[model samples]
Target: MARRRPVRAPEPLRATSMWRVDQVFLTRRGVRVEVTCSMVNDQGGLRNLSVTAPTDDPVQAVRHAARFIAGRGNVSSARQARVRWAREQTTTLQDELIRDRQLEDEFLDEFEETLSAVRDQQR
Candidate 1:
């Protein structure tokens, strides 16, 4: 009889002051990337910020999500620098998509709708 090794339990999610990539998966439209920012408040309560980005590439999606969250404030200078880097990368990707004519009208409509919804929610 062969002995089986015990399975280790999955690690718990750690809260961080900066946004961290939580999950990435494919969707019918494109790849979806989810990020989370968690921190403990002065009142000992937990605060969390989460956002998802739908894009062709997971890396670009993550950068987009990070840039979005970083705009919300309370981020460190180092994190802000990282966000700037992400913004540049995202811009390059967008240019490439435009140059390649890879962006579909349907995708643009959906993206505009999502962007409007986010803006509405912010207000």
Candidate 2:
């Protein structure tokens, strides 16, 4: 019997200079924002990555997506990268809301309204 070699993961793109944010917009899916970003893949081909931020704040969502693409980190695969990126963006947004009193108040007001609507539907 011949022994098989284990498959190694593809190396991450080291030069992120080609990466850029294409668009950032709010999705219709209540309080969700979608960020579309593009970059030159390792194969010298153009690739687009779209990630979502589960927040009502469009400004903060855009910033979070831009930072994720600009940050130096390993991106093994699109699925893995997106999951990691979205989690980081959510955490950063939460931290920002905690630090900004006005932003926090606004977010809370919107959240309470959403909750109230849901409760009305259930009752």
Candidate 3:
């Protein structure tokens, strides 16, 4: 009689290219990545940020963190740097939101002024 080899288990689930993506959450391996990006206007109104990434890539995990920050909140950065900055900025953003009075309004005003200056330079 011959001995049989052990069977391999199925691979864990991950985000696939076929996923129906939302602007808010991207989940994989039971890890939920919630995105909250925004742009602060000169009028003190916070606007959402846009996040983009390839779903099927293993690198998407890294992008997920950045997406979570840039998706619906006022986080800024691009590519890998975005992911790195997102981690620290996200936490600071939360703390600012919690304790600081009128933090959102202040951010909006500052952002708007900065944006206006950039646009002016671009013209």
All candidates' lDDT scores? 0.41, 0.45, 0.36
Q: Model 1: what TM-score?
A: 0.32
Model 3 clash pairs?
A: 35-68, 36-72, 36-73, 37-71, 37-72, 37-73, 38-47, 38-73, 38-74, 39-47
Q: Which one is best on lDDT?
A: 2
Compared with the true structure, the alpha-carbon lDDT of candidate 1 equals 0.41
Every model's TM-score = 0.32, 0.36, 0.24
Q: Write the per-residue lDDT of candidate 2 for residues 1-123, one digit (tens) a residue.
A: 999999999877565433322222233345777765544545566666566766756656544554454442322222112211233354465643333334333333433454455556659
List where candidate 2 sits over 4 angstroms from the true fold: 1-26, 41-44, 72-123
TM accuracy, model 3:
0.24
Model 1, range 1-123, lDDT digits (tens) per residue? Answer: 999999999856556443332222222233554544443433355555556666556455545554554455443221111111222234465643332112222223333454555566779
Q: What shift in Å separates residue 72 of candidate 2 from its native position after superposition? A: 4.6
Model 2 lDDT-worst window of ten: 76-85
Better of 1 and 3 by lDDT: 1
